[model samples]
Target: MNTPSVELADQVARAARYLRPHIQRSALEGKRELPTPCADFDVHRLSEHLLGSLVAGARAAAKEPLPADAPTTLTEPPWVVFPPLLDSLAAAWAEPGAWKGEALFAGSVRPASFAGTITIMELTVHGWDLATAAGRTFTTDDDVIATATAVAAQIAEGARARGIFGPEAEPAPDAAPLERLLALTGRKSL
Candidate 1:
């Protein structure tokens, strides 16, 4: 029987697959610029970052070497790049004996358990970012949103301490928990 954590990882894998096609349809070509929630990135660059991050996470998950062909220059349109990368990631995560129980990055280390949770949160939030950048909208499944919110709340303390929420912004009283969570993380929606 699969562990609950593995089950959740599988769910995330499925969602990533579902998101791939929509992400590929996003307008990320020349001359048509779209805005992104990330202050420093336009839509295309944000997508590239997301893809790079996904590749990094996949490498961590599988304990595999980073692909030699991975794009070092982060300028490729996400629609042109992410599908194959994400597909490879999904496959890597799905393989038996692939998901290591621990990962090391730079001078830090983390459990694969937490890594999967973080992946879920990253994909959900970045999915929202992609949709916003494209001037489109997409809804995450309730379970995924709840999971992301929980993960976000857990990480918010550190992020908040680092002034991620900005100095003068109080949490919105009327916002839903998820909305508050996103707002606290500096994402105010599309």
Candidate 2:
């Protein structure tokens, strides 16, 4: 086990906090199929991806072997299960080993820091997606938003090329922090 970066783990935990309630709100509102800013994913599919990513993050944090066929969609209601899954992801990332080793993601071995960075992006960006689709407001701490924005900018081009994200939407001159983050992820404020 290798020592982890406390700041990175803190970001993951904070993002989990930011995302949790919106998921519950979306589920309670029964807006699973509504279109999200992601374009390709409805609220349900995006929630499924969030849940799956949390599971993978926890497993990777512990340095456990990843499943070759992890499910991308949830059979259970996301709101019912996602809170705990998000909690576990935060807990796993908090561990010392999670920051120092390589982790498997999308069938590739990536630096553990890379995995952690994307996990933050997943929670914040998709969290915003779910909230928007459900017609709810989303917000997060400044530091959390800052880290997410940096991660988004770092991976935006590659993510776009892989079709995971759409082409970047231009933001207004005075776009807010969250809006800027969303734009980098190819989302426009709804």
Candidate 3:
């Protein structure tokens, strides 16, 4: 973390609003079996993962113990909790010590700032997954994309070799910021 000019928490909130439309639409469509760009997740399953990720992020930011992984989707629709869940993540990170030192991640320790970056990337990348599944466009502010791009590159430096992400496809040098962000994360083709 180079100490971004725009706070990571702020960008997380804005990215949610930008992606909210697509998420709402996909949920409303009720096409649980529809395929998304994320190969392993279908609409319903991805929605469940989205909900879990939201919960995980908020907990991580608050320095709370992360809930154990579950094989369940949310029993009720997530619309009610989704917004506040994202807001909670942002709110927690806005606190003074949220990004300092280390945070717990699924029973292990990780750098808080790096975990925060992963939180943002989850929303940006998976938000795109939801959008693409719903046949919607995925566009957010350049600030969000730029921060995400930088963060993804940093994470990929270590994780790419572990197959945490597929080999990244290059994007054109002049491509839109979001496109580059996606490309660097193994989500877009040049």
Best by lDDT: 2
Ranking 1 against 3 by TM-score, winner = 3
RMSD of each: 3.7, 2.7, 2.7
Question: Which of the predicted structures, 1 or 3, would earn the higher lDDT when compared with the native?
Answer: 3
lDDT, each prediction? 0.64, 0.81, 0.73
Give the per-residue lDDT of model 1 (tens digit) for 1-190: 1346566667578758656655765344552356676555666666776776687768767775556686645565666667777777677667665545776421257766556566777787777766677666656566666767676777777756865333223566786554654665677654
lDDT of 2 by residue, 146-181 (tens): 887887888888999999888888889998888888
TM-score of each: 0.77, 0.91, 0.85
Instruction: Decide which is better by TM-score, 2 or 3.
Output: 2
TM-score of model 1 (CA atoms): 0.77
Tell me how far the alpha carbon of residue 36 in candidate 3 is from the true structure, in angstroms, after superposition. Answer: 1.0
lDDT of 2 at 71: 64
Q: If the candidates were sorted by their lDDT against the true structure, best first, what order would they fall in?
A: 2, 3, 1
Cα lDDT of candidate 2 equals 0.81
Best-first order by TM-score = 2, 3, 1
For residues 1-190, write the lDDT of model 3, one tens digit per residue: 5765247768777877776776664454676787887656787788888887777777777888865663247676656547677777778877777877888864579987777777777888888888787777777888777777777888786667765566677888787777777777677421
What is the Cα-based lDDT of residue 172 in candidate 3?
86
